[model samples]
Target chain A: MDLSALGSCVSQVSCVVTQTTSGLISGMLLFLVSCGLTLIFGVLGVVNFAHGSLYMLGAFFAYTVYVPTHSFALAILAGAVGTGLFGIVFERFFISRVYGSDVLMQLLVCYAFVLILDDVVKMVWGASYLSMGMPEAFMVPPLFIAGGVVPPFYLFLIGISALFGLALWLLMARTRFGKVVRAAAQNGDMVAALGIRTPYVFAAVFALGSVMAGAAGALAAPVRSLTAGMGFSVLIESFIVTVIGGMGSIVGALVASILLGLIQSFGAIGFPLFTDGLMFTFMAVVLIVKPTGLFGQRVR
Target chain B: MQAKGTIRHGVSRRAALKGAGALTLASGIGGFPHIAKAAGKVIRVGMNTILSGRVALVGTSSSNAARLVIDKFNAEGGAGGRTIELVVRDSKGRPDEAARVVRDLMDVEGCEIILDSEASSGAFAVHEVMRTRGVLCIHTNSETSQLTADPKMHIPTVFRSARQGIQDAVGGGQYAAAIAKKKKLTRWMTCSPDYVYGRDNTAQFMEYAKIFDPAIRLVEGAWPKLFQPDYTPVITKILQEKPQALYSALWGGDLSAFIDQGNLYGLFHNIDTFAVNLGDYSVLKAVKSLPKGLHSGSRYNRIVPHSAANEAFYTAYTKRFPGQWPTNWSWQNATGAAFMCDALKKTGGKTDGKLLAAAIAGRTIKSPFGVKGTITMRAEDHTIIDYAVAYGITEPVDPYLTDIQMADWGAILEHEAEWKKKKGYA
Candidate 1:
């Protein structure tokens, strides 16, 4: 090939690499947000609309912690723990009362939480948007991979998300709490008959789901502007991801998030305006093909 | 009225009280006629702006500026001894919500005047409500040209107290085109939000850029969702295309996020990024690594007007809100409040919508941000004119902007009128 043709080939390769990395970066954040959303559905059999609000709270907590400590790692931990603790309290007071109740009641309760938390956030953080910015560790130079300019922070995001997914998998698969949680999800009455203290397990599961969302929010805080409506978009996107992945499937959430992320990244390049609609279309197609989702089980 | 300001010319405390007492006798508090009630009456002005969404900083600045102006006016015994009271409400950046809030403000809250600081998204809705309600309204932050420029959309009671997109487009195009000429940059790209304000601003800016620099070719236009959490895809696409220059109309949190994300990809290193909204001190200062030499239109930097009045306004604003510099919305709302106060003074503190609007039309108010110490409410369009329209290169340090280039108002007017005619708005 001639010099110009070679240059064109290189440019195409560059475009692919950059777009792929962008997709992964977005996908990882999506996975973190939706994994919890799906888990609530999976274990509790309740659609927690409050998930996104909790995620927003996590970001605020992270900001509150990060501002004083000036440590991103510590902030991430604080976000997770802060949200996890709140989740426990919420489950104890609100979610607990709605167990075995109508789905509408559960939904109403969670929606109420969303409104209350929204106001609480506004009262605390004020109405203005905020940015965490990158900590010093994540402020390194961009890494060039095959003519693609990738921020090292992007790589860190991908790495951290993977680690989180692995740790979550281990917690669910290898630990005794994971076993009890899975068992409780399968047959809460049977476990109660066996005297496993299922209420405690339920609270643990809810808090665990919240922790995942908090970590995602904390991770996203650096990359995205924090605002009162920040979680609204994420919640919508995560719902789509959860639906496509199967509402109860962790592995499905991961796969769907990555796929949707890639689609969004490339769709932005090809059809910038329709990128928002493309994912919805994808979800529609998925629903048509598999109403139960890719890995979703039948209704409880 | 020619320069010092509309009503700021040597009006002392005693003189204001005297004028107030005289107006009370002459007007009898616009037919209230009860001395006790008239002495305690206040003109209520309502504000509906984004206070909880992506652009909440705009509302914060706007409300703060309104308070600054209103408090000063109230302290001076208001317009002829009547105090002006500001009632601020958050629109939350939704159009439907803005309309609802505005209706509530007018009907339930009994606000005689409205100072709207919504972006174009919500401002359009506010416009419809104002048209229906016939409330005297000053759009303080809605920069969309059609808000005032279009005759069909005109309400005699409504006036724009902020810069219009066409003016910025003309001024910015002229500013950016000069550098493009010097650097011989022919290829350009745009990444404005996918909305009316964004599309119109970007297209107008590019049209004028191509006009000034004939060699310019717009390679592509990337339209991002407003308040989108990420701009990586947009950045990557721009990087792939490798345009010599890029322009975006994203503002507030979106702009801050875009800049932060772009910095990651080294997007601005080689590209001459000209973002119209980047000059807001909060947004500019918030960028993690604000790339130096980024071109932007003046958005309430105290240095741009380079006048004592402008400096004084900035100093006072900063003093009022410690450690917080005013955004573009601050001065626009300040000017809007000033316009209202001056008009009220002219009308002997009458709250009639048409009467107040008539007083506003074809009048100039003294502004720290004015080109020649005053900005005019044009009689034709009811939009502010002669406000300093400028562009500058950004820095990474304090003041955050340098190499200021002022846009010629004559050229701006000539092109704007042409643009208006082309759009059939004239």
Candidate 2:
């Protein structure tokens, strides 16, 4: 390439690098939301269609609770804890019956959950967009990059995701609860036969997963506006990330999420409009190439 | 009036005192029950828009517009001192959900006045409920003449701020036809979204062009289903048709996708002109690049009019909401809000639904666009006959504006009038 052309390309590459960092931050948020979705799907073996709504609930909870407490830390905790309780109730009352059912039945059951949750939200929050002021700390101007301003909170988002990942990894790998859950996921029948209370493990995992999603949403609220359907978008992306990362695989989720984030970051510059579609396109490619995803194992 | 109120309604003195207190506390309440009874008299404005999903951009914008207007009015001490609470529901662009929203807003929310969405079907659904109640509906952005034409749908309080799909087609078709003829282009083709709004818009344009030049051949016409992400197939069909000009009603994401594909195929250099309706700021913000010399139709252009209202609104709006400016959709929202405010101001803050509706019906509220257009709420159909603006692409700007120039609203309105007259429909 000519010198001027080469220089432009380098500039473009550097720009992509900056966006990729932002995308990684975004990916971390995605993982927090998607981790719960995959866990619920794996433990209960049912797709939780209302997981997105739970994410939205997390944000709303944060918005309301944080306003009174005036603490971002408390707001994040409220989002997680509140959604965790909601998830437990959801799993015990609504999801427990749908377990071990046909895929179609499973889907229908979740569909019903979606309807019930939507009405409940309508009753509680009413039918209006409610926004809250970003906390004083998160309001700090973002870091500068390539003639563009990057919100510092995005960096905070990355840090939070990493912390969640480390904590999740250690808990699952080291704790007795994690051991029981792992065995249940691998062989529910054997775990149940051993009198390990697999059902309780299932419920706990569902609640824990939802809490992670809620925390992610609480963090995301300051970065972007929250609306009723806000959870729906994240739900789709989280599913994609989980599937590409290998269902029920934490390590796989981390790798796939970061990779997808980089792909999206560059995609936006190359194609601003289609950047929304780019994540789906990437999922399609990965699924087609590996079918089992990057870290997925064959059932046999 | 006092004796008549007591005798006819049989309201006792104790009940009257309670009612008075209810009126005083209307602005402070946020929940359903409280908001419903706030200001002692509750007038709920139910809004249905694409609040989530892929189409949330426009919906979010609509919600924000509603919020800004409601907040502004409430701050001014509310309409007739009756708290006007806006109850919003997301339709997710489904007809069934939209119908539910309409039902819930009317039956549950106790909204005396309703705001219809940008989606045609959603507006029609809400229009049904509003017709039954004989309540005024300030249509923020939906563009369907069918709602106004149906007699069963008197749409008692329904007033549209933006031009109808029919008007867009009429304005866009003539502009494309005239430009094609002037440039010695012969054949023309159209590729619009396959829905009432898109179909009605593109078809109207083509039909009028046929009326103008009978000898001209319609080389090809493609109607892609609404929200069809992949336009490569449609683009292939358009290229194969080899028409001298291309006319489309692609808006939002579909419009953005079409422009990207169109530029890739060197269509801009090949075609005489590509006229698009609703192809303004939202579409411009989505795309990274645009093919040079594209034509677009719009309602409000920031650069079109240099009026006081326009300057004040534009300056404040841009400053408050950085990276998001008022587009055609946003402009319609601002215009609707401005008109509502004007009517309220005229009535001395009296928000009696019927009285406000009548005041708006005969009034010509000044628009932020600075066009001294009479927004007459037609007593016959209850539709607001508003003006349209169209523009063409000249250059690209960084971070935004890669596509098209702002068409002057006056030019488009004048063209629309001439077309209406020519068709003997004026």
Candidate 3:
């Protein structure tokens, strides 16, 4: 090949690599958010409509914590723990009442939570976009990969998400507690008959899911703008991930999130206006082909 | 075929008419006294704005500014001995609610004049209501070019006090073009919200920049979804393209988010950033520590106009609302209220919609932030003209701009008529 041809090939290769890296980072962020949604639905059988709000609250709490302490790590910790506690309270008071009720009742209760949480955020923060300033370490320099300079923050996000994913896997797949949670997800009545406290398991799952959402929010605070309706924006995307990944499967959420991130990153380059429509269309196609989703179990 | 007993029980049409007439007479007498009491006591000005949502700051600040102006007018025994009573209704940033509140303001509250401080979408809906009701409306804070420029949408009774997007775009574009020429930087890109306001503003800026410097070429454009929290993909795309300069129209939280994220990627160090709406105090305060040398145009910086009127208003406003920096909308609403008061004074307190519209048309009124020339309400379009268009580099403090460059209104308005004609809006 001529030098010009070689240059063109090299450029194309670099473009692909950069896009893949971008997709991976985006996917990891989505997984952080969707893992909680799927977990709550898996064990508790309650789709938390306010999952996005919890994510938003996480970011806001991080901002509140970071403002005084100036420590991003502490902010993330406080945000996750604070949101987890809030989830426990919500589950105990509101969600508990609607347990085992009609699906419509469950949806209405969660949707109401979405509205209340959104308003509560507005009341506390006042409706303006806020930023969590980037830490000095993240701003030092960019790392070059495939001729594209990638921000270190992206790598940081990817690393943390991977670590969390592994931790969750170990807790779910290897531990005795994990076995109980998995068994409960399959049959809560059977687990209760086996002398387990099912309500505690449900609350624990809800709180854990909320903590993941809060952590995602705190992590995203530096990368994204913190605004009142940010939860709705992420919520719609999380719902898509949950549906496509089989609603309650963490592993399914992981794969679906990566697929979505790839689609979005490349689709944005190919067709900017149709990026969102493309995702929805993919979801529709998936639902039509496999009614139970890629990783969902069949209902009895 | 009706039963005889039921038919007898039903009142005859004649008796019903007599009873209705008696009730009407009683209502007229009761309402007459209230009408007389309201006649010359107060001039009710109704405001429909987003006061309870994500963009509530815009509405609340605008309303407060209008109230500030109204309070001053009322304190001085009002305009022609009639105190101005401001009634604000929250629109929630929804168009339907904006229309509904506007109707309630006119029909139920009997407001002679209306001030709409909604965003562009809601403003258009409220404008339709104002046209249908024939109520004079002074739009306090919408910046869509089409709202006033589109002849099909324009109503004689409606006028905008805020700066139009196109005007700001043109000024910023020219400023960017000059910098690009001096620095030998031509490759340009845009990252704006994916909506009418964002797309139109970006297009306008690019068009003007190309016009000013024919050597200038657009590398690419990125239209992120409106209020998009994450801007990583867009930032990455810009990096890959390596544009020498970028024009962004993202405002409020979206802009703040982009700036923080872009800072992480060292995007600002590699490129010149010219944002049209970055000079607002609220946006600056929200971000706290913005990268220096980011260029922005046409935000109300108290020092840009440097007039006594502006200084006095700033001093009074800051004192009244401590620690709350006045936003661009605050000044725009204050300007609108001032213009309305001038028109009212000219009309000798006559609140007739058509007459008030006529009184304001082709009239020149001094704004608190005006630079000697004052703003004119163009008779042809009923839009404010000759508002200050200034661009400057961002600084690390409150009111964030330094070394300001002011644009001549004549130059900016030169192509506006032709541009509107090309868009089929004139």
Query: For residues B1-426, what per-residue lDDT tens digits would candidate 3 score against the true structure?
Result: 457665466788888999989876764444332343347568989899888756777677788788888888888777567888899999888999999998877666767799888888889888888777666899888888888888887788888888887777777778888898998888988899998888888888899988888889997788899877667767767776788999998988888888887876788987999988898877887774598999987587787787778778878888988867678899889988988888888777777788889999889887766656488888888888887788999988756788888876777888787788788876
lDDT of 2 by residue, A228-249 (tens): 5567667777788877987777
> How do the residues B208-290 of candidate 2 rate in per-residue lDDT, one tens digit apiece?
66665665677666776565433433553454446887877777656665665455345566776565643455666445454
Per-candidate DockQ values are: 0.58, 0.04, 0.54
**Candidate 1 or 2, higher TM-score?**
1
- CA error at residue B349 for candidate 1, angstroms: 2.8
- Kindly give the stretch of ten consecutive residues in candidate 3 chain B with the minimal lDDT sum: B29-38
Error of 2 at B315 (Å): 2.9
What is the per-residue lDDT of model 1 for residues A1-300, given as tens digits with 9 covering 90 to 100?
123422452358777788899999999988998998888889998888888887898898999999889999998998889999999999999998998889899989998888888878878887677788888887776888987778999999899998888888899889988898889999999999998999999998999899999998998888778877578888888999999999889998999999989988777777666787889999999999999788787768
What are the Cα lDDT values of the candidates?
0.86, 0.66, 0.82
* Candidate 3: residue pairs that collide: none
- The CAPRI class of candidate 3 is medium
Q: What is the TM-score of chain B alone in each candidate?
A: 0.88, 0.80, 0.91
Better-scoring candidate (DockQ), 2 or 3? 3
lDDT of 1 by residue, B223-304 (tens): 8887788888788878877899999898888998998888788788899989888888878777767889899888889897
Candidate achieving higher TM-score, 1 or 3:
3
